[model samples]
Each structure stands twice: as C-alpha cells, then as structure tokens.
Target: MVQIPQEILDQAKELRAQLHAAPELSGQERETEGLLKDFLKKRTTLELVEEDGWFYGVHREGDQLPNVALRADMDAISGENGPYHGCGHDGHSAILAGAALACEGKTLGKNLFFLFQPAEETGKGAMQCREMLKKEKIQAIYGLHNLPGFPLGTVMIRAGTFACASVGITLLFQGAQSHAAYPENGRNPAFAICRLVGELSSILSPENYQGLVLATVVHLLVGEKAFGVSAGEGELSLTLRAHRSEDLALLKEKICQQAEALAQADGLTLTISYQDEFPDTTNPPQLCQRFEAALKKSGIPVSQLQEPMRWSEDFGWYLKETEGLFFGLGAGEDCPGLHTPEYEFRDELLAKGIQSLLTAVFL
Candidate 1:
C-alpha cells in the first residue's frame, strides 16, 4: 500500500468537511470549481486545465503522453435543508486531490490525468466532459464510488455492466377541454391516461429481454386541479432502466408505441421526450482483472460483486470512449444510503480511496 503523509490526510479531511458543509447542485458548481482549482494550484505541481465546470490535472515528464486517467465527481445532491453531499462526492473529490498531491514528485512510465467532474447526480457531467476527454488521448480511466452496507475499505467490482442504463421520459397528451357536466362535447384524455398507465406494466419483466428491463412511473399529472373543467391535457413521466443500452432502447420504443396507440384511440396527441439519460457502465474483463490485481497487491480487502448495481452512473459515458473500470469502495456496513438527507461521507475512507485509486493508476 502507498503510504500517504499524515499531513496530506489531515488536509484532505478538512477539505472534505468544508465541501460537505457548502454543497452545490449539478451544473451550478462554481464555488466548488473555484475551491478545487485553488487547492490544486497550491498543493500540486501539475498543469491545470479547465472547461465547462470541469477540470483536470496533468502531470507530464518529457514526451511521455498520459495514458491513464483517474476521475472523481464533484457535485452534491439537493437535500431537504439545502444542497449537501449526500452522495459522498465530497469525499471522492478529496481522494482525487490526495492522490494527485501524493503523485507530485513521483516517477512513473505513463502520464496521469486527475479529472474532477461536476453534475454527476443529474447524469449530465460526463457528457459535457466528453469533448474535453477527446483531447487527452486517455487509454484507460478509473473511478470509485463509496458504497454503503459493505465493509469499510473493501473494494467491490465486477467484470461487465458495473452500472445500469437509465433514462427519464415525459409523455405529454393534448386534448380539448370541456365543462365537467358536458364532457362529451370535447376530447378528454382521462381514458388515454388510464389505458397508458395500465399498459405500462407490459414493459416490465426482465424475461421479456435477455437482460433486466424495467419502466417505472415516476410522476403523473391528469389535467388541471379545478373540478369545474374536464381533464383535457395530462402528462405521464416514466424512468426506464436496463442492464444494456440496447435493452433500454427496446423498452423505450415499446412504451412509446403503446402510448401512441392509446392516444390515437382517445383522440389525443402524444409527444415523448427524455431527460437524465445515463448509459450502462461496462468494465472490460482485462481492465477489471488489472484493477483487482492492483488492489490485492496493495493488501486491500476486495469483494467480487455477484451482480451489477441497478443504479446508473454518468461515468458510463467515459467508458464508451476508452477501456476503464469503475469500482466501489465500501463506506461502512451500517452507513446510511446515498442521496438521503441523513447521509454523510465517511472521513476515514478518504485515505483508503486515494490509495486504491493511485494503486490502480500505477498498475
């Protein structure tokens, strides 16, 4: 295991606490960005590059090019009180910083890029950083997320499909409204809405496809709240998820087709739009083996996941461009789940996460 200085660990803990106290939401991460930039400038001897609310630190020697990249997400989730680091991103950022600081004067054969990304919770950060990555020529990238309900400091990973694909779809139904007493005079979409909700069940059942496919109704709006008017316009929102991108596409197509047919029968126009799309994160077998070997060599406890996580991660976008592994560092066996108001990052995992990431990069 790489030994990180006690001073470095202390600084990381302080930074994580500061970040946790003042969290920023998705695209609005200006304060977080500024803090990170200043920290990198003051602590590391790396060249800083910034673009579109995301930044990277590059350490180069002679003509050697950067082949491996370590990514850490920087944005937090909106909590009941306000924005907070309920997803452990604050710790992730601190780990990346600690790793970069430790590598300041180290010698290595390949160049290193420490990427700090924003808006990971909403699934837009990775897509925005896609163009920036194109200029780096990175061959393999690695990222880690803190996982609750697992032994602390344990590394959890799988070979393929580390995270599932997901997308949010909004269905808009338009029809003519009429007085509640004279509903027959105008087109009311209540029937279509009811039929669509019933048919949504058809999209479920993983057996329909070779892998897991699920469509969940997140929100539904049926016309105005006023009781005097018959419901004319209604909206339905569903989040689609699958183990593979192809399965998600198939599920989306089937849902849209069913919605259209129902709308046509009820004399309503249906329009479909999507948001918060996240691609499935797949880890190449070779890359997974390499990462696992590094963790074992460092004497870190490792766990092999029996199945891929059902949650979606934006890091899946990065894997599309290069071979990479996204693993999980256990936060604690009894820690609160991520994205909850009670959730807070475990400070002790900062050093372990940094060491794990550094080990993977060097391997």
Candidate 2:
C-alpha cells in the first residue's frame, strides 16, 4: 500500500469539516465548487478544468497511456430546515481531493482524472459528467460510497447490480369544479386517486418481478380547503425503484396505464411527468474481480455483498457509457445510516478512501 503522510490526511479532514459546516444543495454549489477548485490549485500540480457547472483535475502521464477516472459527488441532501450534509458527500469529495494530493509527484501508468461532480443528490450530476467520459477517452472508471453498516476500513464488493434504478412520477388529475350543493353537476376524482393508491401494492408484487421492485407514495394533494366548492384537481407523487432497468421501465408503464384507466372512468384528464430518473448501477464481473485483486494486493480487507442496495446512485449514468465499478467503503457496524439527522462522516475513512483510489489507478 502507498503510504500517505499524516499531515496530508489532516488537511483532508479539515476540508471535510469545512464542507460539512456549510452545505449546498444540488445545482447550486457555486461556493462549494470554488472551495474545491481552490484547494486543488493551491495544493496539487494537476491540470484543472473548470466547466460551466462543475470541475475536474487531470493527472497527465502520457498521451499514449490509458485514461482512468475517479469520481466523487459534491452536493448535500435536504433537511427539515434547509440543505444538509446528511449523505456524507462532503467526505466523498474531500477524499478524492486527498487522493489527488497523494499523487502530486508520482507517475502512474495511466492518465488519472479526478472528477468532482455536483447535483448528485438530484440524479442530474452524472448526466452532465458523462460527456467527460467521451472527451477524455476514459477506458475505465472507479468510485466508492461509504456504507454505514459494515466494518470500518473494509471494502464491500458486488459482482452484478450494486444499486437500484429509481424515478419520480407525478400524476396530475384535472376535472370540472362544482358547488357543494350540486356535486353531481361536475366531475370529481377523489375515488380514482384513492383507487390508484390502493393498487400500488399489487402493481409491485414480488411474483410479477424477477427482482426487487417498489412504488412509494411520497405525496398526495387533493383540492382546495374551502368546503363550499368541490375539488377541481389533485396531484399524486410516487417514487418507483427496481433492481433492473427493464423492470423500472415496466413499472412506470403499468402504473401509468392504471392511472389512465381510472381517470377515464372518472371523466378526468390525467397527465404524467417524471423527474430524478436514475439507472441501475451494475458492475461487470471482470471489473469486480479487478477491484478485488487491487484491494487484495494492497492488503486491504474485502467482502462481497449478497444483495444489491435499494438506494439509487447517479454513478450509474457513467457505467452506461463505459466500463466501471462502484464499490463501497465501510464506515462501521454502528455508524449512523446515510441521509439521517444523526449521521456525520467519520474522518478516519479519508485515508482508506484515498488509498483505494490510488490502488485502482496504479493497478
């Protein structure tokens, strides 16, 4: 294993603390972006490319060498009051920067690209970063997420799907309004909305799908609060997830069909919209073997996961375009779950995360 100086590790911890204290939301990380770029500029000898909304640092070895990419997300999740760093993205970005610091004066066989991405919480960041894959001719990519329920310093690996695909579906129901005294004169969609909600369980039944599939009702809005007028419109929001991309597509189709039938019967116009769409994050078996081999060569502890995580990751977008592996770095067995009020990234994992990145590129 490459030895990183304790002073460099301390610098990384300081950066993580600063990031955690002042968190920014997705697509609005101007200050956060500047902070990261400044760190890279002052501390490293990498060539920095500042894009319109994001940035990356490149370690040039040779034009003929293969290009390897490493990515870390740079945004926070929403909390009760405002933007919060509940997802440990602050640590993620800092760890990647630490790796850049370790590689300041070394020449690995491949050209290394350190990608600091924004808007990952909304599943839009990777969509923007995918262009870099083609532009850099990135042959392979590697990244890691910190897992809370595992032993610290241990690396988690999965051969197939590592994270599920998910999408947000919004259903708008429009109908004619009527006075409370003569409700029969206008169309009402309360019954249709209720029925659609009721059928959610059946639509995602286990027997209908080869792997895990789920539909969660995140929001429901009826009509006006006034009692004098009958409701004219309503909206329903659902988050759908599946282990396979094909199943996610089918789930959307099934739910929309059901909503359309219900709306037609109630004489209401139904409109469907989507947001926060993410694809399944799959690791090719060969790449998984390579990751495991890299860690083993460095004497790092490693383990395989039995099932795919239910949460979605935008890193899936990059894998769709090139070969990549999205592994997990264990935080601790008793660590707080991600995106929770009590969660904070452990500073000690900085070294391990940086070591893993160095290993992948040097291999």
TM-score for each of the candidates? 0.97, 0.98
lDDT by residue (tens digit), candidate 2, 33-127: 88888889999989999897899999998999999999999899899879889989999999999999998898687799999999988899999
Identify the runs in model 2 with alpha carbons over 4 angstroms from their true place. Answer: none
Residue by residue across 232-304, what tens digits does model 1's lDDT show?
A: 8999999999989999999998888988988998889998999999999988988788878888888888888
Q: Any idea what lDDT model 1 has? A: 0.88
lDDT of each: 0.88, 0.91
**Number of backbone collisions per candidate, in order?**
0, 0
Candidate 1's C-alpha runs over 4 A off are none
